[model samples]
Target: MIANLLTIAGTDPTGGAGIQADLKTFSALGTYGMSVVTGLVAQNTRGVREIHPVPAAFVAAQLDAVFDDVRVDAVKIGMLGTPDVTRAVAGVLAARRPPYVVLDPVMVAKSGDRLLAADAVRELREVLLPLVDLVTPNLPEAADLLGVPEAVDEDGMREQLADLVRLGPAVLLKGGHLTGPECPDLLAMDATGEPVRLTAPRIPTRNTHGTGCTLSSAIAALRPQRSGWPDAVADAKRYLSGALAAADRLNVGSGHGPVHHFSDWW
Candidate 1:
């Protein structure tokens, strides 16, 4: 059986994030993964050194090729490096309208290095935000995406996440980076919906490279084989928390390092 999932994101040479991490997550979770590369990134777990975005035409073409041939049950979008790439991605998502779409709003790396330009943030919100089913933004990324100054715990993270909900799609405000030993990954839906908070003990490790991409992709892989949004988020949280716990034992880079996706994966 071909359990196909598509990852439309940038390329990560370190195999820690972007398309590389998404594909690894899909495979680990028993989905045969296909990818549409939007940008070419040069980096390790430490940080992104360079980014060369694929041409807009080529980016759209890649998606066209995949859609024309593959049976994609789910799709994950990440790291569209430029406004052009973002527009291209939005177009593909609108056209294909896959059953499950997970959007990881990858603006900056966990190391605080810039993966996207300041101006491209507007393009993402205007073009891609409404096209996907769900958007997973880490604390900082969520803040940036929502025009909020910062995602400070002292400044009320829940309200910030609630504001992010107005951006159209369901928002999962990942609280892993919140200042605490225990982290809660929050799911804030549209208005009138009860927010679901899935909390997990923060893993004691520094190898958290590519966590957002991995989490969203894992959820995409599970959705076709599982239930709906909240269920998918729960499954993704379980898989990622396990990956984080095994992260320090992984040996992929001299920097933050990659997750050990093969162990205890969904």
Candidate 2:
């Protein structure tokens, strides 16, 4: 059966990040895509200008509307701008638990703008993190969740992973922010097993706008079809790498542009 994947996130007018990016990823990966908008963002590859959040009650209504009818195989959650919105999403997920849930802790944009508020970070960590199956956070986001400085090296990343998994979900800690030729990602869970490490050579490109959103959504789209989390994450990484490699083929914007979500097809 084709996986029915849902994305709960904000909007990107440029179709490079947030709900737009998530939907594109779902379709590209051979899944039926659905969306529940939490906020409307006015931005492009260059930067974010304005944000208008949907009401918390309305956000719950949207989730209810979907769950009442559709069989959501998996869900990918991104940019919930406020604490109220965060709690709203968590409330529904706790009630009607999906088969798989992937949380992309989208705190900052590729253009260096803040997408999530400071107080909402606490709400995400407390209410949402425990409810999801997996949480994907980059270097700075990991530090923010743990209330510590960003990890500078692999050792630091390993140390932080130990603490993060204690928060009640498996973590995919991305090491792209570290200055190195290779971009490594670690999958850590509470099970008594060694964490899986996957690394790929960093693709040289300025157009990496919606990488976080794309990767997390790809995992959600693939998880229902894959045997386990490790395989799903590995496949998702390969997909993102292809998109990044083909990113330069398209002319999108002046600043950090988007990866080619349909690189394999067109």
Candidate 3:
């Protein structure tokens, strides 16, 4: 078995997102996968219907259980829905201090459903974001964290990237949801002091569920095994684009569907 990469996120019963996507991503990229679910989400590819958070103590215990035994090379975090939940995740991270932490500030789902509590958004900024090594926020999420409303355009996207970088960790401003046909992603950090913009042709389809979780987890898993962050992202971008293209042939849920996790595995 390959060594493990831990995913700390919510559970999606539909197997289209959250910890499900993260695990699939880790497995697809040749790693052992494990999960510590902070919340149980009643969700499909369409949207999140309800969320029931796991008890804070149990969340702690789950984290402790995994970190105690497995040598987790990296971690990918998503959907800590409450301030208390975020705090519990923080406590676990503090205790384990995994080598690489990739935070996918998962505020909204693919089908326009909000995944984060407003109070927890603030807590993520104050408590969680600082401790992470990398923070991947989509355009709208970057806008929300930076206190701006109109980030649907390119100029607005770049401004929000800078604003998010000030919050502590390196910020990866995902521009895939933007209007342009070409998806341009900005990797902004203090060390670079300039946005490493990666532009790719946007794939046109509605079946893109759990993409953020998968992408961030892929980045988390690949970044450690590979040398360069930019290269890792570039390679993962190609991988995900292929996954999305492959998504068109598969059928899952009724709404925005899932990418094919086992496209190359078989």
Candidate 4:
């Protein structure tokens, strides 16, 4: 069956991040993409200037409309900007029980804009983590979730992954920011005998505007149809690496340009 994937996130008019990137990833991977916008962000490759969160009830309404009509093979959740929105999502997912769910705890932007509210962190931890199949967080986001100042090295990443997996669902700790010639991501889960390490040579590019969204969405799109989480993650990494390598082809915004979603097409 063709996978019909959904992304619950904010909007980005620049087509670089948020819902835009998620949808692009799903399509690029041969999945039908659907979306429910939780917030509208005024942003570009340079930075996020402002964000107007959708009302909690309206967010719920969007979820209802989508879930009521479609068979969502997998779901990817990004920037839930408020506590109420987070609760709404958790409740809805609990009711529908989609085949797979990938949560990207998008706390901050590449340009350093705070995408998640400080207070909403508690709600996300309490309500959403248990429901997700996997939680993909970068080093900084893993640190924030674990209440640590930072997760700097391989040891730190493993420690954070162990702590996070206890909250339920597998954890994918992205090491993109860790200093090295290669970027290694750790996938930790009880089902797996040991933590699986995924590594890729660092792609040198300033146009990596929507890497997180792309990676999470790619995994979500692959999960149901792919063999297993580890395999899905590895495939997602390959896709993201290709997109990053081809980013220069798309002459996007002046600052950090977006990874070329349709890189394979051209």
Whole-model lDDT values for every prediction: 0.85, 0.95, 0.85, 0.93
Order of the predicted models by lDDT, top scorer first: 2, 4, 3, 1
TM-scores, one per candidate:
0.95, 0.99, 0.96, 0.98
Question: Relative to the unseen true structure, what is the C-alpha lDDT of residue 33 in candidate 3, on a scale of 0 to 100?
Answer: 89
- Predicted structure 3: clash tally: 1
Q: Give the total clashing residue pairs for model 1.
A: 0
RMSD of each: 1.7, 0.7, 1.5, 1.0
Best by lDDT: 2
Clashing residue pairs, candidate 2?
Answer: none
Q: Between candidates 1 and 2, which one is better according to TM-score? A: 2
Q: What tens-digit string does per-residue lDDT give for candidate 3 at 2-83? A: 6579998999898888999999999898888899998999988777888898888888899999888889888899988888
What is candidate 2's lDDT per residue for 165-211, written digit by digit as tens?
A: 99999999999998889999999867456789999889999999999
Candidate 4 lDDT score relative to the true structure: 0.93
Better lDDT candidate (2, 3): 2
Error of model 1, residue 169, in angstroms: 0.6
Off by over 4 Å in 1: none
Judging by TM-score, tell me the better candidate of 2 and 3: 2
Clashing pairs in 3: 207-257
Greater lDDT among 1 and 2 belongs to: 2
